[model samples]
Target: MSLLQNVSSPADLKGLSAPQVEALAQEIRDFLVESVSKTGGHLGPNLGVVELTLAMHRVFDSPHDTLVFDTGHQAYVHKLLTGRHDFSALKKQGGLSGYPSRAESEHDVVENSHASTSLSWAEGIAAARRLSGERDRHTVAVIGDGALTGGMAWEALNNIAVDKDLPLTIVVNDNERSYAPTIGGISHHLASLRATRRYEKVLDWGRETLTRTPVVGAAMYETLHGVKKGLKDIVAPQEGMFEDLGIKYLGPINGHDTPALEEALTLARDFGGPVIVHAITEKGRGYAPAASDIDGDQWHGIGKFNPETGLPFEVSGRIWTDEFNEEMVRLGAERPDLVAITAAMLIPVGLDGFAAAYPDRVFDVGIAEQHAVTMASGLAFAGMHPVVAVYATFLNRAFDQLLMDCALHKQGVTFVLDRAGITGSDGPSHNGMWDMTISSIVPGLQLAAPRDGEQVKQQLREAVDVDDAPTVVRFPKGDVGESITAQRQDGSLDVLLDVQGNPEVLIVGVGAMCSLALTAADKLVAQGHSTMVVDPRWVLPISDDLLRLASQAQHVVVIEDNLVTGGIGASLRSALQEDDQWQPVHTFGVPKRFLEHASRGQVLEEVGLTADVVSTTMLDRLGPTASGRSD
Candidate 1:
């Protein structure tokens, strides 16, 4: 049996000899390369952290020693070591999660997949351990250098450093990229440290030489430490950023070297105070294809691919993201006032095409969602029609900015929320179910949900034209369902009125929900029930035409991919009630809770958003008497 096969947990790993452990690291790497090739996960990050994770397991007693992973994509190796090695059904419906799950393992402390914030979690754990009188246990936070660019990481560092006595070890995994190339002050500081070779050499020599001295050795060591600190301040002004905050800064060590990592970790364990270990590892190590790729973001999260060739599995043609990119390019050409913005996700949201086409018009703010939102608002306020293209989940980070800066100020800011639904495989942190519920609370904001590629184009145009208040156009992650030609473009209202007669049931479908609604309508028609499937392009600001249709219909079913509570359904229900019409309304959407990792289709199916489920629900509601009337 292989070394990997023998190991079920860290305890099992601890039983192996040093040479055996070294061999096991290679075995684990091979397993990862093979497993992720089939499963399609954060392969690059996981491949980079094998030795670091092995060293961590060796150094610390986990479940007792709190180990927090920032942006849990890199925790795949940690997960495997903690006995979640069954990668057969990884990220699928009934399989292992993409991120750390507390339910899955005792070792997995935090389930944060977002960049930065692990330091905060580590500090919290350290504080709790102290309170509980478990001082022997260590709190280790493993964060990528890319994640350190985020403001929250610095805030946590500042707080952690305040209490020098706190037992914490922050492992800075410097892979030189987070989705894209890392930006900001922290990246530069790390780069400077990496360039400086004398810092490590001097420290090592000083420590060795000072200890050997017979008398006044301790005093000489203290004096040498002060001199080293003074020199570091000159070489790297920001070198003492963490140390100044009261935390001791360790080496910019080679993270891939098992012995080196183990040694550094041992030192950290021995040190009874806050310390930051800066370890450098190449992202996508061992895999030449991924390592050589200049654009690391593209290879960061991949689909099922051939391990040998690094070729992805075939998927459906052009998605909504592609369509958005095409439209944005066209719009930018037509309107010089139009500007595109994203929070470090230029490639994912299909903005790479737009950025390439009009580099001057596109702005990529690095991992600062709140800043991106407000910056877009500023652009809009300055007469530029700013379109902030962001993932639906990430937009939640800037809710207050969207409300106060854009909505309250009545800035003509257009928000194109991509992946605005149950985005599976990426796990819970990535799902866009909260966009509708959260945006529904933003006053003076107009919200839209497009059915397909054509609707997305039309709605985007309309949103850009609305120069009065903030407007949001949301669409799902995958391909646009059944390409439809543009029919009519009524000013700010893209209507597809295909109602046969005075329909009793009006299926008001939001963005991606239109396809399911149409299928449901077909089933209702077969059951002899007269139904009207209307694509109400705008979800918010309840259009007069939409309200009129809703008032006339006996029952209205509001279909959206977002949460049922506090969604567009609630707005529709309120609009119908205020009209003095007692029309019964049913909301079909995801429940207001964190769902498990699964495919978008599987998640939708589970939540009864599929065509079959919708059809059955409509049939059950509109029984034999209602089924008598033919369209």
Candidate 2:
């Protein structure tokens, strides 16, 4: 039997010998490559943490001794060891979730997918344990160097530093990159520590002595620790940042070495206070293709790839991101003052090309979303039109900054939100559904939900033209299909398909939902009802033309890829209600619930956002009349 096959639980790992553990690490790596190639998830981060996780499980008991993963992509080994070996249907509906899930395993402490949050969680749990008098229980947080770039990690560090009494072991898994190379000051300091060799040797010798000769032969620890510190000042005078913070600083140990990792973890576990064990790890460790991945973002997260060639099995068509990238490059050439910024996602949001084209103009602000938005506002204030391109889900981190720093100040900053709606496999936290809902409350921020490639460019151009308030241009994850030219225009709203006379139903399609609405429109017309479809590209600041069209129709239906609660449908319904003609406005959209991982099409069908379901719902409401509503 394979070494991995035996590891059904953390308790199972306790019986393994030294050489056996090494064999298991190699076995786990082989398992990861084969399994993840068929059903893609995070490959690079997981590869780096194989030995680290094995050592962690060996050193501390899980469930009883709490362990946390900051960016939970590295928890694949944890999943494998904890009996979740079924990798056949990973990231698909009813299969294993890509990130840590509370529903999946008791081993997973928190469902953290986003970076720089694990440290704070560890602190809180540690604090709670102490208050409840569970002093024996230890809380350990494994954070990536990339996550350290985020402001929250620093906040947690500051809070943890002062406590000193908190029994939390923060493991810094420094791979030198979050998605790409981690930027800013903290990363450089860590790099300097990595360069400074012999920290491991010196720290190991000192820690061993303390453990060996307990002053007063145990129970009295302060005497021996004080002696070790006094001797350390004479021997190792190079005081590091962690030492300055009043927290015990350990070595930049080799993360891949199972024995070394276990030794370090054991010492930290018994440290009895807040201690940071910095270990240098290689991201995409065992896999050659992933280890040397250009910019590191491609290997960070993947979809079914060829094992031999390391090429993705799935082929994709032109999407909204491609159009956005091309436009940014063109804009860069024409307008020198136009700058683009991203929150450490240079490639994912299609800002790589923009950064390459306008080398000086584009800025990657690490993983700090709030800093990126506020920095863009600063750039705009300095008379430059700054475009902030980021994933739709991540913008939730920067809403306060987007509102106060940009919109309140009337900064000419354009937000290009990629993966705008129903971002399938990445799950609920990733979909850009909340952008429109959040924008509804933020004053002076204009919102755009482009239907296709043509509208993407056109809306982006129009957004940049506005110099006063902040403008948002949002588009979805997949292919940007054929653009449907409008028959006419209603204010800024484009009427994609308009019937001859006063329509029985007015179907307003928001952004990518135009295609879905158009299909639904065809079904509605077949049922012998006058139906018109309008693409409300600009979803917010409720259009004058949409209200007029809603007034004409008896039953008005609004379809969007966002939540129905505070979406375009609700706003349009409110406008129609105020205009005296109260049309029965039916809405089709994603429900305000945490969605699981599935294909975009499957998710749409499940949420009743499909063409057939929407048309049937509208037709059922008609009920043989097909007449204008007189309600």
Query: Using Cα atoms with residue i matched to residue i, what is each candidate's TM-score against the true structure?
Result: 0.92, 0.94
Model 2 — which ten-residue stretch has the worst lDDT? 230-239
Flag regions of model 2 displaced more than 4 Å. Answer: 203-239, 626-631
What lDDT is obtained when candidate 2 is compared to the true structure?
Answer: 0.85
| Steric clash pairs (candidate 2) | 554-629
Could you give candidate 1's per-residue lDDT for residues 485-522 as a string of tens digits? 33454344444435555787888788887777778878
Q: Candidate 1 — what's its lDDT?
A: 0.80
lDDT string for model 2 (492-555, tens) is 7798898898998899899999998999999888878789999878888887877887898888
Q: TM-score of model 1 relative to the true fold?
A: 0.92
Clashes of 2: 1
Q: How many clashes in each structure? A: 2, 1
RMSD in Å for candidate 1, one decimal? Answer: 4.2
